[model samples]
Target: MDLKGKTIAILATNGFEQSELEVPRDRLKQAGATVHVISPTAGEIKGWDKKDWGRPVTVDKTLDQVSSSDYDALVLPGGQINPDLLRLEPRALSFIKEVFNAKKVVAAVCHAPWLLIETGIAKGRKMTSYKSIKTDVINAGAAWEDSAVVVDQGIITSRNPGDLEAFSAKIIEEVKEGRHVQRNAA
Candidate 1:
């Protein structure tokens, strides 16, 4: 799908999975979409590598500075701490709700779906996330699956970084299609 003029907001903070954020961000930009990295802070956010923390990514905007009208989609990258922190941030959770309420595309990978659950946006949605979050997803009213990628009602979710390829593709596809309804298709 072509995303020539689309703008995607990526919400993340310290401890986000490095590849989960970077790979999709690069792929989306290559597809002609502008990607903005928004966080709780305005400077930079650190990343979590395989066994240790990694470099920080420059932040484009703070959570307080973001608005659903400023972007076409929202992306939440997961790591142990990333989504955990986001789920507790009122502003961050509210931003996610705004995206869902606006019917805009929202894509999340791995533990990132935790934020979706916290935002109360996972109800009746089918999704996939890190194996450890199976119960969490189910408890949040979403059908949990073990797929590489799942797209339901404009919400895109993946199991982990390993599914980044499929995850990224589905996000672009949904954004281009502009229409999605919850289904167990994936």
Candidate 2:
């Protein structure tokens, strides 16, 4: 299955988990999709690797320059700092809402689901995140599960970096399935 004309957007900021963004990006690219790193900041953003800082990833586009309509899917990579900051940006949160409303695949791993909570679209959906945010995800109305990966409607999630393989595969599968329109209003 080739994704020759597909475009996927990875929304993240400084402190994103290195592998979470890189692995899926590379995997999708290998499958022929155009992958873009869109951030609120310009230039490059540094990644978070375990207990220390990691390599910097180039930002292909800024959040202000793109919209949900420009991509087939949205990927959110988690780190304690990344999604925590992104959720506060009105534009970023709004973009998430637009993507979810459009029924596009919105995949998030680990703490990334926090952004979903901020967009008010996580309610009533089944999801999973890093253990630390279980309560937060549940409080937001999502049915949280401790699984390697979870797909609800078009929202895909995984527990942590360890689940990247499953997470990325699920994203590819969901994007290939096209739009999921049965979700409630955000």
Candidate number achieving the greatest TM-score relative to the actual structure: 2
Please, what is the TM-score per model? 0.94, 0.98
Model 1 C-alpha lDDT per residue in residues 90-135, reported as the tens digit of each score: 9998888888887889999999999988887788888899999999
How much does candidate 1 score in TM-score? 0.94
Segments in model 2 whose C-alpha atoms lie over 4 Å from true places: none
Candidates in order: C-alpha RMSD to true structure: 2.8, 0.8
Of candidate 1, the 10-residue stretch with the lowest lDDT total is: 177-186
The lDDT of each candidate is 0.89, 0.92
- Number of clashing residue pairs in every model? 0, 0
What does the lDDT come to for candidate 2?
0.92
- Give the least accurate 10-residue stretch of model 2, judged by summed lDDT: 176-185
**Model 1, stretches more than 4 Å misplaced?**
179-186
